[model samples]
Target: MPRTEVPPVLVTGATGRVGRVVVDLLMDAGVPVRAVTHRSEAAATLPADVEVVTGDLTVPESLDAGLRGAGAVFLVWTVPPATAPAVVERLAVSTRRVVFLSSPHRTPHPFFRQPNPMAVLHADIERLIAAAGLETTVIRPGMFASNAMFWWATAIRADGVVRWPYGAAETAPVDERDVAAVAALALCQDEHAGGDYVLTGPESLSQAEQVSIIGDVVGRRIAFEELSPDEFRRETEGSWPRPVVDMLLAAWGATMGRPAFVTSTVLDVLGSAPRSFRQFVADHATVFIDPTPSR
Candidate 1:
């Protein structure tokens, strides 16, 4: 089919870390793009060619406009589960396929097997999508590399010393851009229907090692100070949700002796090696560096 005749892929979470990249990749490939955002102001952040529409996942009726002529939907569920069935039902009626951004809860690794409310939510949503019978692909990306910026950038920028628990716990932090690329491919091609992929970085690195990689990129030797799980909890008590802190502590503690679950899925699907942790840090080195100080 010609580009003009291609039905737009409606992207939920259109301004998010992954969905925004998915929007751009789809547009680059000549597929028409329809982005769904809760706030209409988010349209200014997207490409001018993208058809931005207002939609809220919690209110399934609000999605009708964006789903009206969409061929596929990139579903990013960050809301409560109350309306998933209704939303999936609407997608089944309006779109031919859906690419859901989910987590690797079913992976048998000890790290992934920990009790996670988010995982339960992801599994429930997956079941709903299966029941809906839309051509579906599940993209599960382990630890996003950008999380380094979220978790440690403040400390790194301040003093270059990270105080956190489970410094030796290992994980392969996948790049969001790579995750988005695979999602775009799945959205544009019918062959990816029913495909399930778990994406990870090229190598497994410990939390301390990940910090060191960032330090290396920024030309500084960052100190890694391990905190007891209790100390971490106390430190982040009011700032971070209790459940999230517990979940991370459990996963990291469980995987302390084991290497992270690494995968070749990114290479298998994209025909290129996934970006390494060092490369990811290099690309965003400025985030880890303090701008006010001279290097």
Candidate 2:
């Protein structure tokens, strides 16, 4: 738990948005890191000193090999029940502490409480880990600021008009970097066991308002248009799961009528302020900037 103790950290989802950041942070802090991924090629971007292990979380046998000698683990639940038992079992046997990247289901807001099936899935994993007797910390992050890149990056780069559903629905979008920072701290230290931290940005903003901040940062004006829920569903059906679609629509609907919840857990844990939406936009603007403009 002290700053002087350094543990070998195994980070699952090592190539994902937050996982990669956690890996980098641990390495920067001089902690030994074992980056776990399904493909070794994905580990190429990581530091050569990092121990890259190819293992499937769905297989308990594979995890023992990847987790051998590691003292702490960072778990990101990407799949369903098929892999939960095997993964948690391995971590319980091998690791001293585990930090779970999860969602805020017990938040009591209709947005978070909307009979979410996926919430049940995460809850199941949480229960599994707790029963296994490992020191556990749960991080529930609100909507990520990075979601905008997937939702409107193409449109912003091509037509410069970002169209989506519920433009006025409010959300306190947490930066993925902040989430990763907290995860890194929890993984490297043992003091945060049994902590359920709800991570959020400093301020709440609507989708339209977030876009306006992006526009301001880029020194350009961007337009936002709302789509009917049906139209939005049809457009996004191929990309989003049905349950996730329902969850988002319900959350957005609830948000339209009420103020979003903003939390300072990132500051409380990491001793610094969470990044603003404007900061996120500025940091990732290249994703939306036009690659080729008309001559």
TM-score for every candidate vs. truth? 0.97, 0.95
- State the lDDT at 48 in candidate 2: 83
**Per-model RMSD to reference:** 1.4, 2.3
For 46-129, candidate 2 gives per-residue lDDT tens digits of: 778899998887676887887887888999878667878877887877887999998998887767877678789889999999
Show the colliding residue pairs in model 1: none
**Model 2 clashing residue pairs (backbone):** none
- Per-residue lDDT over 61-180 for candidate 1, one digit per residue giving the tens place of the 0 to 100 score: 999998998999999999889999999999999988999999999899999999999999999999989988888999999999999999999999998899999999999999999999
Candidate 1 segments whose C-alpha is farther than 4 A from its true place: 1-4
